[model samples]
Every structure is written in C-alpha cells, then in structure tokens.
Target: MMAFYFSRLVEIFPFFLRGLWMTTKVAFCSLIICTLIGFILGMLRSSNIVFLKRLIGTYVAFARGTPFVVQIFIVFFIFPEWGLQLEAFPAALLAMAIMGSAFICEIVAGGINAVHNGQWEAASSSGLTKLQQLRLVIIPQAMKVIVPPLVGQYVLLIKDTSVVSVIGVMELTRVGWVTVVRIPEGLMVFALVGILYFSISYPLILLSNYLERRMAI
Candidate 1:
C-alpha cells in the first residue's frame, strides 16, 4: 500500500497545490473587503450619538450570532426576491466580509475605548478636534492594543475561508475532500488536510507572537 500510495502522492500533489492557491485568493479578497467595512463600522461604533451606536450594534450582533453558511445561503438564495441578485462567489465573499467586519469592528472599538479618558483630555487640550484626536492621537495609540487581536482575527479568517468551500468555492478544504474521495483513504486524506492547514496557520500564529513581543506586550 505504501509503494502504491507513493505513486498516487505525485498525482495528488498538483491538485492540492492548486486548491491552496484558490483558498489563499478567497481569503485575501475577503480580508480586504472586511477590513474596509470594519474601519467604517469601528468608527461608527465609537460615535457619541446613541442612534448611530445602536444601528451599528444591531448589525454587529446579528452578523456575529448567525453562522456563516446560513448567511451564505441567505445571500445567495434569498436576496433575489428583493431584486438583489448575486452569484455564488460574490455572495460568499459578501457574507464572509460582513461577518469578519462585525468582529473587526468590535476589536477596533475595544482598542479605542482602552485609550483612557486622560488621553482624550490631553489631546483635546492640545486643540485636537475629535477627528484629529481619533486620527492622530487615539488611533495610533489604540493600534498598539488592536494589532495583536487583529492578527488573531486574520488567522481565524484564513481558517474560516475553508467554510466557503461548501458553496463550491474551490478552496483548500474542497480540494482535500476531492483528493480524499479519490484515494479511498479517509484517515490519510484528513490527516494530510490537517497538516496542510497547520502549515498555513502556524506561521501566522508565530507572526502574531512576534508582533506582540515587538510591542513589548
């Protein structure tokens, strides 16, 4: 079986690599959209206005509470009823971004809030407007707090990309499933898949640790 499988490994190698590439692409696209939307949501989250805060709160809560697959199905199938049509890839990307952004927003807001009131007072005394304080004073300092958690979120997003493959996104998990089915070795297939994810995720965790250390945290 070992000799026979050695031959099959060569056959499996190329498809596995292709699947990894596709998974990376989906994760990258989702991260960009999520970060952009999250910045907006984060800013809104810290606003003094109650209505704006509540509006963002409702969105964050719902997006976080529901499962991503459920969101994906809803966006792909349900939106057409409201004249909002989206294909599978776009729909999946949209749902992933929204779910990620909600979490990112909370992370950012928490960081901002951590910057004590004294910091805000000092910035205000220096004639910094609210916008200026946020841009120059608050955000830069808050970034020290946010960076570690944000890195964790990014790793999570990479793993979560595996879920999108349920919609036929051709990501890493889908590719592994295809390989496993062909091999007739459930354990071997899943074991290889786990190794592949570990290979991707471990480096990210190391990077996060490095950044935290550099921050002296």
Candidate 2:
C-alpha cells in the first residue's frame, strides 16, 4: 500500500518538490528578517528611554493582539494609499516578519526579565556602563533563558510560512493547494503538508529540550 502511495506521490513529486523548495526559501528568508526585527524591538522595549518604550510597546501590542491575516491585508491593501506598495511575496514576507517579530521580542524581553536584579545592581556597582553591563553580564545569562523561546519562535515562524501562501505567494502550502486542485487529493496533499511541518519542528523541539537541560532552567 505504501509502495503504491509512493508511486502516486512520485507521479506528483515535482509539484511537491517545488513547493518544498519555496517553503524553505520563504521560511529561511523570513526567519532571518524576523530575527533582526525581533532583537531590535526587544531591545527597544527594554530601553530606559520612556517615550521610546511606549512607542515600541504600542507596536508590539497591536502586532500581538491582532489577527495575522488582518495585518497582511492592512499592509498589502490598505497601506497602498500612503504610496507604499509591495508585491505579493514581499508583502507576505513583511506580514510574517511583523507578526513573528512581535512574539520574538516578547520572548526576548521575558528572558531578560528572568535574570535576577542583583546581577544588574552588581554590574552597576562595578562601574559598568549600560551597554557594558548588557554586553558583558546580562546578555550572556539572559541568552540561556532566551534560547528555548527563540527556538520555539523560529519553529513558529517556519510554520507561519504557510499562512503567507494564502496571499498567493507560491510557497509550500500554495503549491500544495495548486497541486490538489489538479489532482483532487486534498487529504493526501494536506497530510503531506502536516508531515513536512512536523519533520522540521520536531527536531527543533528536541534541540530546545537539550538546551533547556544544559541551561539548567
């Protein structure tokens, strides 16, 4: 039975393979972009600057609270009147970055907060500048706490590549949908999609567990 299924999959293999490649590209690109955005927003939110914190807080709040689909629509359609126009792929990528970044930023801030205050006080007493304290002391310890969440965020970002395909970005899920339209094997196609997502995420989950153990958190 499995052989027969593999034969059928082989028949439709190119479409799925193309889809897989697109998924990889989208996920990898978006992950890198989201990482930068997340780190910046995370740092800004933790900044001692008052107004900057509130502004960053509002952005994070809206990104976190709203539905991702709405964000995609707003950026792709509604923002056009303001003379900002992005093609489907860039728009989808932006949406993914924005949504994922907000979550990542929160994860970072949470990790930072988890560090004991005494560490900061001790660093300050040692005459360390804020940048020096962060670079030398707080960041290293916060990093251990942050890894599990950041890894989980990366997995989530990869999973999110599917949602962007809804806007016709021709990534994995979009390719799957197109193939299913031709083949009319919705269950098989979707099942394969689930398998692909699981294959990537499960390994990350294991790695996260290992890091958590090593960090002793």
Q: Which candidate is the best by lDDT?
A: 1
> How well is each residue in 87-155 modelled by candidate 1, as lDDT tens digits?
767877887888999999999999898888899999999999989989999999999988888988999
Residue range 66-136, candidate 2, lDDT tens digits: 98888988988887889889999888888988888889889887777788999999999999998899889
RMSD of each: 1.7, 2.2
Q: What is the C-alpha lDDT of each candidate?
A: 0.86, 0.83
User: Candidate 1: TM-score?
Assistant: 0.92
* Whole-model lDDT, model 1: 0.86
**Residue 95 of model 1: what lDDT?**
79
Candidate 1: count the clashes.
0
Task: Write down the TM-score of every candidate.
Answer: 0.92, 0.91
| Model 1 C-alpha RMSD to native | 1.7
After superposing candidate 1 on the true structure, give the runs of residues whose Cα lies further than 4 Å from its correct spot. none
Clashing residue pairs in candidate 2, if any? none
